[model samples]
Target chain A: MDFSLTDDQRMMQESLSRTLAEASSLDRVRKFAADPADRGADVWAALTDFGLPGIVIGEEYGGLGLTLLDAALMAEALGRAVTPVPYLGAVLAPLALRLAGSVEQQARWLPKLASGQVTAAVAISEAVAGARDGAGLMASDGKLSGKALFVADGHAADLLIVADTGGVLHLVDGTANGLGREIMTGIDLTRRMAELTFDKVAAEPLTGDAGALARLRDAGWVLLAADTLGACDVMIEKAVAYAKERKQFGRVIGSFQAVKHLCAEMAAELEPCRSLVWYAGYAFDAAPQESSLVAAHAKAHLSEVSRFIARTATEVHGGMGITDLLGLHFWFKRVGLNRQLLGGPERVRALAAQMQGLTG
Target chain B: MDLRLSPDMEAFRDQVRGFLGQHKDRYASGAGAERPREAAMEWQALLIDNGYAARTIPKAYGGYGAEPDILKSRIIAEEFTAAGAPRGFANQGISMLVPTLLEVGSEEQKIRWISPTLRGETVWCQGYSEPGAGSDLANLQTKGVEDGEDFLISGQKIWTSTAAQADMIFCLVRTEPQAPKHDGISYILFPMTTPGIEVRPLKTMTGSAEFNEVFFTDVRVPQSAVVGGRGRGWFVANATLKHERGMLGDPNATEARFAALIDLMKSETVDGQRLIDNPVMADRLMQLQARVMTMKFNGLRTLTASITGEAAGLAGMVVKLQGCELNHQIAALAIDALGELGVLYEDGPHLRAKGGWQRNYMFDLGLIIGGGTAQIQKNIISERGLGMPREPKLAVA
Candidate 1:
């Protein structure tokens, strides 16, 4: 009946957090956010050195062979630092391949993806779920066309795992002919997004069934929820620290009920999310039947709660919150972007209702 | 992160199921009927005898006296809730006062109070809040002047639930006027029939008098009635209040209510479409579903912390705040889903769920404010959990 992280999981999270703290300080994050040429090469290298990219990859494929729960913890660490890195795709691409890719395909790419020798981007949002702005991808006659928007870490990827209009996942080469990548500048500079234009570009389809796609979506939701949980934690911490030190009316602002309540509300809202995300991650591997529904719950709930924390934390910082010096907006924007990524709360709830047979 | 129970626990669950299967019908006949006091006492005694209730208290105290096992306790609760079996006695006496007495009461007090409380023979009501000491309870002015072996009590206690039916009252009184507010209090227990004690029902917005205001004018209790110690009542009361908060924020109750809500949504319709099929209502239901899941999982995490002896900290502190608010919201949403039928109470010919949702919506609001106001909870979370500074003391006038 144990429902807590194992000691090893805790140690792993602590180690990753320490590495991220040293590698992606606020100054480094700010500098990386401002520089167009910087692709967070250093931060990615630190994560790779820490074996994070391979945490969930198969041990047979030059990786640690950990579970999704471990990867979610790593995502949380990256979120706390708002580290400028390509982690979403690094984890999700391998997961999609592992879940649906052919044996030969897994043998070819798993080792490279696991060792950080190659970087991959995932483009599932437009075609599989939450399609918006007339954006989608289609595959026919061994060729891919149309556009996939909001491709996480698309710019520097050597490989792309994309879902087509029929919900079939395919592997595409980054430098394939007629494949065009246009970077979309989102408010959250910590992670980059791109719109990939596919004009009859060649793509090899994965052989798995629709269940694999659903699993990928569930994994994506859990990871995103974990990331939001991490970001909210940092925002609350920053707000509480600022309140303790910042003074108004001849005393520290934390002594005031209003400021204290703001911090308290944020904590109250976010503390539950930690367990929620952990349970979702645990369900991903240990409780397969409930995986999809729990994932949706985690995603939808955190999407709403993180927004509150982000806003309230920013308000706690007073005018300094808006200033670039505090870099509070990084977390705030990160939370904002997370709410809409991979489907917002409304769509996620709709999916949950449908899953429960509550809606047609 | 395994959630599966052990084989031993599973066997224990089956044992519980079998026990309930055999004995539940004894009390099932009285469901929805007015209080069947004798039958309830018999059922409580059966539970205590079977280790289904008072499982952790000592044998001398007339409990089952099993070793403390959180998982077994959880299993008992789940099985009882599932089978609709009577879960023995659960009142302020058993839930809050019994635990406090076990922790700090004298052997005489334990032998005298714990056994009867567990057996449903003794009903108790809390006497912490007064009109002046609702949130800032240390400011209580209920004086207990020492006179020989007894303390002469005089004060008013407000919002005392079950005061009318309670046979005993555990109270807080100011025993020392010159001492600091937090240090001048005493926790005393006495029979509700004590001379000069008055209980007047205070009708709530729910249109029922489940709570009351009790006046104590020269009500006398022996010095032995003071549990924990005389000037340490504040600390003892805090301990009991912790249990009170836990009781009010029970995830099991919320889960059951949520399940009932789903049933209502599925059974009720508007404009020839089921309410569950309505997109707006479905979305709202899913939102509540998320919160319900949060409460359940967070509860599991806290239980794990307890079993492992780890500090739950903020996770434990936020339960009452989140649970109470979420329960209120759930009831509010249920009413919204009820549509035109929502306004119908027990008297209406077309009343829904026997007007339970309407009653709960109003009662849950009281819950949020009663154990600790949401504002006070926030203060505690910020001050203790987050290590935020306390509000500075204002200069005394």
Candidate 2:
């Protein structure tokens, strides 16, 4: 089994690492956050220029058809930059369509998604008053009526792919008459989310089954996990770099065991989160049967680990970490939001348990 | 990029699996010994011999393929454990002595040493930590005076595992005491049967004497016995410790413990429900299970990086640290699974897991302290892995 990234994947990582560091630096993130819509266009254009917008879309649909592993690697870079783009939504919506959408539907949407002609949002979330699982929604008579909370990048999406209680995916125009999209005040300023309330919105049902929908859900989990993994990498890097330079008690604070251990613990914890993310992304593409299992494992485990790393990293920066001056909160908050996105540790563990036949 | 094995590797795994399948007799006795201790040793030998062609020399040896592929190493480990091989080949002779010899020993020494150790014929114990030097091992007071073509050594080494059973001891001694503590040392190998050498077993808190304190009162050895140069023992000893860290407290040990815990929980019931059916217990198991899975992937990632000539990054430093922590948690969870019965050390109806939890809970204490304490691990991770500056030394009063 090859666990190393392919050469192209490495190139994608390096390219994005360089591009994001320059284009979406902390200052850039703050600027983008001021007007998320403007940020969305700029981020989308850069990603499209790098051909990342279509990284996962099939070549036949004027896209790259790269594995989710590659896109997930890019997602990590996005996370590192806290880049304000609807990557999870844009990539996953196309992925859902690829896995479940009809030929006509994919033909219409995949190309635009690849070329940045349109943005998409994934509505796999449940209502605020319901279970975190997407089973809270139901579509009746080709008109969808349910609340999809935490709809990522919902405000910027030209299209929305919403899932129902039966695991059927329904495509709806973002500007549909009955669709109500409310922007969410999320913890991470670097990204955006929304609550989409569907009131008998005209929906085009995708030709997919429960199984396909599960794969799509797992793909989302893997992608989100990759994002957190990226954020974690950045947190430790920032923490270590800060520790080395920040002096106190007549020596660099890194020389102090207390601060040293914090950075060390974070490094050790994140090392595993990375491996989990890679496998989760790879499993989605190469090992479909075990995709959900690894995805659940990655999402749940990274969610827990990334949070620890984030906080410990912030702790490493001392008072400066919690302050807006260092802006380390961008990554810390990004990790916090990623942990709760899709589902948190306990919920994902339950999904993993079902996969293992340990619980019904 | 992928985790699926190639057809060739799969075929190799199938062959290994077949050999393991044939010998399904359990090794570790739970109050009842299923196989002789000799049989268990032989089973380990069989595993080493059986996976010979599949075994790749470690990356340190510049041999990378087939076996050094972490997946292959893991598969071999899986089959060996499935066949009930020992938790690990914790033999200092193989894990530490052989690697050190291969790195710095003379051609004659390697030819004379590595094979016999791998065959379990010549047991060896490390003689690095002395009574005066525990964590700051460089300060060891063990000294060897030059005596034409040999060295007369007189000092004591403590916390030596398997010294009583060892045929030979790989030691560090101060050959040039006037030099700096680190530079004045030498790595030497000598037979445990040498006159004036003594081994006293030290019973640990676990109620077992798996560790020993060894004394060398003017023990003599030929000059050829020194592996690394006389003034370079510190660096050589570091190499052995690196090897030691890689083997001791491996995640595989915890994985085995986890599997055993699950089996016990399956066989056990409380109020007509399986112990694992309890929400609190199940959630804890799931968490441990997730940690174990992450460890597995981390191992693969490290292996993949090693084979690809990429710096393994923090994954290398993570294994032993996380392994000790994970095992402690796993052991704790096992005790939690037993509830009030966990306090029972010996056999009884309420003594779930055949009282293994109590035994493990104590045994695990030594593991976390043995190779390096958790604090020491964190220090290494911080200093080496995170590039943190070393902590200032305290002044001796």
Best by DockQ: 1
Docking class of 1: high
Give lDDT tens digits, candidate 1, residues B23-118.
756763222213337877787777778898889999999999899999999999999889877676778888899999999999999999999888
Q: Which portions of model 1 show Cα errors greater than 4 Å?
A: B28-36
lDDT of 1 at B90: 72
The top-ranked prediction according to lDDT is 1
In model 1, the clashing pairs are none
Q: What's the DockQ for every one of the candidates?
A: 0.90, 0.62
Would candidate 2 be rated incorrect, acceptable, medium or high by CAPRI criteria? medium
Q: Candidate 1 at A117: error in angstroms?
A: 1.0
- Candidate 2, residue B254: the lDDT equals 74
Model 2, position A171, has a per-residue lDDT of 92
* Candidate 2 TM-score over all chains jointly: 0.92
Q: List runs of model 2 lying over 4 Å from the truth.
A: A36-39, A127-136, B18-75, B85-90, B111-115, B147-150, B222-224, B394-397
